[model samples]
Target: MASSPLKTICIYGAGALGGAIAAKLATGLGEQVTVSVVARGAHLEAIRAQGLRLWEAGADRPLVARMTATDNAAELPPQDLVITGLKGHQLTAAAPGIAGLLHSGTRVAMILNGVPWWYFHRDRQSGHAERQIEELDPNGELWRRIGPERVIGCVAYQGAEVINPGEVELSNNGRFILGEPSGENSVDIEAIATLLREAGVNISISPRIRDEIWSKLMGNAAFNPISALTRALMSDIMQNPALAAMVGDVMNEVKAVAESLGARIAISVEERLERSRQIGPVRTSTLQDLLAGKPLEITPLVGAVVSLAKLTGISTPTSATILALVTQLDRENMRAAE
Candidate 1:
């Protein structure tokens, strides 16, 4: 059979992660693939004016790339692949616009953290079959609009930050773990993986994406909130005796919930904390948001886990207590902005 024609790919929410991916696709693959970026505000304006810039340490100059950039989803053609780099809290508001860019065959790869909204969808034994996580999705709007069939679960490890309007500085050259929602194989997902790998992204396919998700969540559920509350880096948070003990409590609770849902996290709490310490001082995304006065992603990151714990009859005292404080902090920050 002949090879399929080149397909169009769009990176919605062209912030740090999406901008880096867009720059790679537009420059790395060039004419082999059509790439578009969806961005807004000053970043979109900057991209339109001078293209996207990537700053790397020890580089002679910044890497620059150009492609179709737009804020309105209606202005762009339907995409064969849409990778959403938006934070968990931004997904619902952007869902309709994302839906507008999808053709019937379009596949959406969600590169985000914490407990996903689709956690209960494919796990029949998780007590809630096909039930939407209201804490994450809020009335099933995203579930009804995007549909789980179009989803490709992902765990993104690469770290990047927007230094300015159109410039992104990559902090880590990490891999993206991709999987289908049903935990099965498909040609469409392979095509997506190939496209990303060709664009210079380290990509891997996982049979149990949820297991990987839970494993990653073990860190997020413990570290992110602690970072935000104490305004401390991962190293300091994990090294502290009291904080480390709290993290252990939170991780155990989250682990029980994950095991109840048939997803096993092999890594021990101490191992996860030790690995984090080895990475040196690192500020989490939740802490960054709190500092920037942006809305914290409470629902998916911490609240959803607590919700799952309750549904499964497991107690998450440490996680719940931290979630309450951080959530209150978020509300106060939002109110102050208003």
Candidate 2:
């Protein structure tokens, strides 16, 4: 679909990251390219009423952009490119609504954290070809509905949040990496990357998307759950000698699992840890979710790691313990919120 025109785009689950991206696209892309966001509750109403406002990282003022904001994706027309900013736990419920915005050649670019639902699709070397990742998708909902064939892998590197209804705040000048599961520099990937670039998004198109997923998973699997459990930021966790050492163990284990599955993580565990530590005092997604009383996105970040470790016959004691603890934390936190 190289010749495919990206005239219409939708941001599914326009929370923090999605809202930030949508705000940029709406203001950056002119009348020629229409950007719409699918949000819910008070956020949607605020966007409808006062437009989506974004405060760039380190900015004093917010940039407001007016575009289509709706609760139901069916209310909008079929989109050409749908970039999802939904968290791990929200996709199943939003799958149908997301599907409603798809046509024949629509590409669903998932800018989610941790392992994606389509991680096993077309990834034969993982020795789990087309196998269901029940940790990420307990049912076959995402796989059956939004077939892996239509997915465009995206790894987000920045932080964004919905500070208030209809307002998004950026933690940094975040960038995104996009690729296809088949590792092809296909037309769809190029088109989407170019469109995002045109909208002032720092984008990179990579062929080894699975490798990228594993690399990012290192931090998500380790720092996120640990941070939530301890209520500390990445820097804080890495500063303590014992916690930092535990994080290193988790990253190494995750690396072993990825290599066993045929994905190469180029960097060493120490380097990854140092890089994460340098990111300073930013709160991890898991930590933020915990403090906000939202559902903890556990499976994709850590549970999936344990599931894969078992598949690869690799021992991940630290990761396993963290997973068990975080899983229960999610349940108890959710219940308490209720």
**Which candidate leads the pack in lDDT?**
2
Q: Over the stretch 1-338, how does candidate 1's per-residue lDDT look in tens digits?
A: 12334479899998988888889888888778889999999999999999999875446688898988999988999898898989899998999999998898998899889888776667654666677788788888779888888899999887677889999887767788998877778888888787778878899998888889989888888888889999998888878999888888888888888988778788987787678768667778888888888998888878988988888888888889999999999999899988
- Per-residue error for 23 in candidate 1, Å, reads 1.4
User: How many backbone clashes does every candidate have?
Assistant: 0, 0
TM-score of 1: 0.95
Error of 2 at 159 (Å): 1.7
Reference-based TM-score of each model = 0.95, 0.96
> How high a TM-score does candidate 2 get?
0.96
Q: How accurate is candidate 2 locally (lDDT)?
A: 0.88
The deviation in Å at residue 152 for candidate 2 is 0.3
Total clashes, candidate 2?
0
* Candidate 2, 251-302: lDDT as tens digits: 9999999999999999999899878778878788888899989999988888
